[model samples]
Target: MSNVKDVIVKLTDVEKEFDGVKVVKKLNLEVRKGEFLTLLGPSGCGKTTTLRMIAGFSNVTSGEIELEGRNVADLKPNERDVNTVFQSYALFPHMNVEDNIAFGLVEKKVPKAEIKERVAEMIKLVQLEGLEKRRPAQMSGGQKQRVAIARALINRPKVLLLDEPLGALDLKLRKQMQLELKHLQQKLGITFIYVTHDQEEALTMSDRIAVMNDGVMEQIGTPDEVYNRPKTKFVAGFVGESNILESYVTQVDEDLLHISLESGKALLHAPGFKNEEMIYICVRPENLLLSETKKEHFSIRGRIVEHVFAGSVIKTVVELINGQKLRVARHPNEEEFEVGTYVYVYWHPKKAIIVHTVEEQIYNVIEGTTNRIYEQLGEKYSPSAREDSHDQ
Candidate 1:
């Protein structure tokens, strides 16, 4: 973990617009020095736009992009202490590896001896010593990526912005590069801001992840926190494979809440919820368990509809009485049941993630009046909102 006092890059209420449409909205992020922060989302989620604004490739309509406490709102790409590596290894086709990596120094009119020394160091750093004379056309995808990353780092910028730099490589090479990039970032202690639409990629390379959706930053936290304890339904669904159930609150105790799902009910440790209110809870497939016998207050009856063999684990799909489906990941040693087997689905109470969905979003929205809004969700405006406020 990077020290809290070592913030190298900070974005405050950043907003960007294309024509009349807002693309990046109210984005606030603090990137610690040496932290590998990844912007992760589906396409058109403004992740690339956010990266461009930080790189000065795209202008922001409003916000403060600060580097080491200095605002960079009007700074040009070359002027800022930052460099970007794009998905396409944008190298000069005719130039050799040495020239390509030394372009920045050459443009800055550095002395020939210094440029030669720095270029040699970079070539050694990327393990391209013998390939210095080779052109991009003669190198592999991974090699060209190393060249691009080397060029981007030659200037020793305070931060590096990567817009899916490994996107063009094959799956095997991409996975390898993820480790290599992470190793390089840690070895150099450079703050890296990466943008990608791949969930697994973000989880693999990121020290922290910022989940974006429809131009808004949905959630930002360590990979484990974001995956295991998502505060919003969007984050829970987008970050990984999740089994979210639509249910109603039936009982609320000191630190436990009972929820009902169709003909089934389960108890969770989520507190501060009103009885009879609608909610959504998320459970990862690995956490979900299936059994032949039902356990009171924990298991829900469901029929096994299908089994998907996915190499590491077999995902068994169960259809509930209300037509909702749930999945349980079976270990290799576990017995595989027939497709039509009737089983009970349950998990540990602490594993359930109470996520805010449309029902929760409507609480803050007062259409005609606050009373009408509360009544619509069958809520009585209880003090539960105070607990939800802490999540915000």
Candidate 2:
């Protein structure tokens, strides 16, 4: 409904506490007009709390919320010009699809003929043309969600908030809905603030993602940003699979930081480190390469302890000489490495990410440096660290 070049919504220093426990800490975020933004985190991470604050269902402890350059912190929920699609589908049991979609219009005092036309268009948009007369209970899970979405979008609100609208659907249906929602957001050009703990769903739909943890915002970026360049140990471990190897930073130069790992010494070139402190190395499972024979380049020798086929990729767990376990994910096409097989584990320097500890100052520094590095590196950093020698 609007161009993304405009700033549609803004939340500054937002916080919420319930029963003397802080549920949401100070959070600042901006929703670009017509952008699809998702609040992604586990339960109790304050995603729902943030959504409620925007919806006016919960009081803001302290902060300012602006909608289209106007302050809405003091406005009532109905006056904010935003609609929400709940996970429960909150459809009236007695109402049919058309009536459900038309309810918001009716409350706004739209004329009867225009209401009917809008409802008809919504039903067609959701591909539920012939099912307008069916009640919520009569429709399947996917259909009911469609009705919920249709109802929310029919109001032409400035922003639409969805709190895990697809959580109740089956696996196949949830995937289908993710794609549909993405397409819908792009087609309608309406600002969407979606909330969900399903990482895959967030990755699949959001134009940008705000990852929260322990009542605080962890990282905010595009899906690729959060996934690839995680700022903290929690973000790196929580967002995806990673082998977090604790290492000591031994040297630092321009665009390169050498570190010593427990397994052995290797060359690490992470750009985030300025101080030669103990840092954790984050390497994705897929980034690790498994070799039957040792190459002339940097590598660690380990024994394959287990091989688990997980549908799309094969997980090979290796025990290094120092007894640290490293996981490697490879495509299913390669010959499998069996249990107890000895192999060399290696990855390119760019695949390694040097992670600082989760202290407040360190966290802030990492968060601050990310944008600069991204502008310079063109993506996430690929870092490697040096170690003393291989043990096992």
Best by TM-score: 1
Overall lDDT per candidate, in order of appearance: 0.88, 0.84
Could you give candidate 1's per-residue lDDT for residues 1-392 as a string of tens digits? 34647988888899998889998888999998888999999999998889888888888898888888888877999999999999898999999999999999999999999999999998888889899999999999999999999999999998999999999999999998999899999999999999999999999999999999999887889899999899789998988899889889888887788888875889888866688978889999999888898887865888999999899999889998778888788887897778899888888889898898644655535533654655566654533563587589
What TM-score should be assigned to candidate 1? 0.90
Lowest lDDT 10-residue stretch of candidate 1? 359-368
How high is each candidate's TM-score?
0.90, 0.88
Tens digits of per-residue lDDT for model 2 on 1-392? 23534888888888787888888888888889888999988897998888888998988888888888889867999998899999999999999888999999999899999998999998888889899899988999999999999999998988999999999999999999899989988999899999999887888899999888888887889989988888777778888889988877677767666666777655566765665577777999999888887754455778999888899998988999899998889888987877888888777778888665558545667756864664577433422211122221
| Residue 390, model 2, lDDT | 23
| Model 1: how far residue 179 lies from native, Å | 0.7
